[model samples]
Target: MAGGIEKLTALKVARLSKPGRYGDGKGLCLQITKTGVKSWVFRFERDGKERLMGLGPLHTVSLADAREKARVARASLIEGIDPLAKRHEAVASNKAEQASNLDFDTCVRLYIASREAEWKNPKHRQQWENSLKMHVSPHFGAIHARRIDTPLVLKALEPIWKTKTETASRIRERIERVLSWATTRGYREGDNPARWNGHLEELLSKPSKLKKVQHHPALPFAEIGDFFKAVKAEKGVGARALEFTILTACRTGEVLGALWHEVDLENRQWTIPPERMKASRPHRIPLVAATVALLKQQVGQDPTFVFPGAKQGKSISNMAMLMVLRRMKRDDLTVHGFRSTFRDWAAECTDYPSEMAELSLAHTVGTAVENAYRRSDLFERRRQLMQDWATWCSTPGVKPKTPIGSAEEVVS
Candidate 1:
């Protein structure tokens, strides 16, 4: 059998199927499982340890093909190289090449998909998709993500930077994020080309300089009492929710997403969990008499939501309160303007501390150091303030308890 090599032939390999490894000599073997599934394996040694490398299934890799593969592996072993390690290196290189070649459009899809779950709403995710499609995609989306450079980013942003400053700024931030994601995933490398600070800032004008600041139009604090009375007279769940929102001075999202379990009717409190809040901190609102009555009215309407939408098992839509304002022919006023209305009323009408008003609005008050030491939510003082607010909203022509010149020093 030629010095114990080439001991098995093609017919011998086909017939030797008794559930064990049969050698074809030169360390190449045909292995048959208990169920008669067969494949070729190459046995070798490197650094005093034994290894087996799979060739292919016996059905596809004939004895001749197996022998050729084994011969190449043996030659590698003789030359002080491990065939298995070399094969692994080749595979890794191929994968890295594939990763580096991923185009910008594909990277955007992957990046957005990865972050879709963390986003607040479908509209937010849609904004990411739409902005990139309209602005960035036309310029460099088909280019390899790794190959994206400063000029490419500039090409996408420059035309819109002045004419549509706010939109351009958002696109820049999003592009920076996608490139950063690509770098983390090994699809791209080098400093992010879309970065603003100390990078793109050198090329583009400051966003704040280009865009005008626009605040939501608010109803004058003096007119809020009449507005509240008009809103209370309106019929529907939205009107009730709007009434509650104004009295509590809450964000539209916070009011709409409220669940029955979050409300404590007996205690006159509504506890909004951190996840639902924009500041990501737990907020406790003291429910005044007006707010408690509003919650009571909503009880029989939905099993879960305090303000249920028309859809089964869903909360009220984000636009519901705004629609109520529009129906009242007050299209000039935004739902969020109510918070500013409350702030103005608290400053002009009440003797309560400014920090109390800020806290009631669920806004972060004072410096980080100040906040760290200030543990109190000032719930008791806040309760009294909210009661006074409710009284003001309910009673027409209520004058400021504090004189204009005698107003207490406001602490931010």
Candidate 2:
């Protein structure tokens, strides 16, 4: 029967029994608990076994929708699918749609959160904020994901694509990423408007010419040992952080915001929490003996931070290291350029594996599946690499001919 609303109201409220059908159908069991709570259930066969799906309160789905739902359930069964599986699939699809309907702001925030360790370049972070502010938020920041289309994304990109091509290109990529997330969840469908394959490239300028790549200026690798010698002549937490940052090959912010808790001095390691890392995974940095010495020397300090700011519990200001460089009359050198500096040294001076060098910089390995299988963080390989780095800094131009220690023994 096509149970109408009137018939729905006329149907008696079925009382619950002990985990058995209530005469309606096989899975359509009503269980009235000993405590008087009433709930509905549907059961069906799939993969040679039985399964149950819950339909809500008697007051909620109502007898009418319940019957209507039951019909859909039976129809699915006739097609050799389990009604319970179908119900869950439908719910998952709906949840995916809800996630897709998430606005541009929501998705990008997620995207940024996702890029925790990957976006080590300071400019990468700046462009994320700048692109959203200058291009995206101006137009579609508040709009829901389902409503986004080529025209809207083009509007976001067209104005600055020619003039600020670099940032514009990155903005488009981020927008595409957000829409792709939306599309996967069912908020939007069809080709991503932000995508620039054969479909989109015709409408816009070539992204390469439009985009300008920015590089952080680092002192030459030949100058690194001298740079550290100069760094030691400086004062305060900023100097210590610079020394540590150069030694570990981490970013400036990672060094500045260093909390005491993250440091495992006894283990000679620093574990950066996922929330603090650019890649959003907790990463371990094996501290060289020199770096450990710096920490222990400053242990009795008031600020719990490895580099405390003027305010309590706050990180040292961004300018702290910059000003340190300027005071040393090396204003031309940047705090961030030190990473490239380390990379250059590892490449030119050492026989370290390329992957080990990259990990020292906290860069991602590859696809998620690849990362899952590569369990080792190559700590021992890096320990020797870092100790070699310290020895290099301990001298001016003399390259060390041999590896420092068995990579594992450095832990002691």
Query: How well does each candidate superpose onto the true structure, as a TM-score?
Result: 0.76, 0.63
Best model number under TM-score = 1
Off by over 4 Å in 2: 1-130, 137-152, 177-190, 366-371, 399-412
- C-alpha root-mean-square deviation, candidate 1: 5.7
Taking the candidates one at a time, how many backbone clashes does each contain? 0, 10
Could you tell me the TM-score of candidate 2?
0.63
1-412: candidate 2 lDDT, tens digit per residue: 3433223232455533344335355345554566666666676767777777777877677666666676778788888877776667888989876765777777677767766557655677777877787789879988887788888888988888788887777788888887887777566678888888876789997876555566898878777887788888788888888898899999887887788989888889999988678877788898888999988987867547777778886888989988888888877778999899888888877666777888889999778899999988988768878888888886887655664344345333
- lDDT of candidate 2 at residue 272, scale 0 to 100: 92
Sliding window of 10 residues with minimal summed lDDT for model 1: 403-412
- 1-412 per-residue lDDT for model 1 (tens digits): 7878777888888788699988878889989999999999999887788899999998999988998999999999889999989999999999888867999999999999999877765788889999999999999999999889999999999999999998999999999999999999988889999999899899999988878778989888888888899999999889988998989999999999999999999998999998788887899999888888878878888989999999999988888998999899999999999999999988877667788889999999999999999978988678878887888889766677563322343222
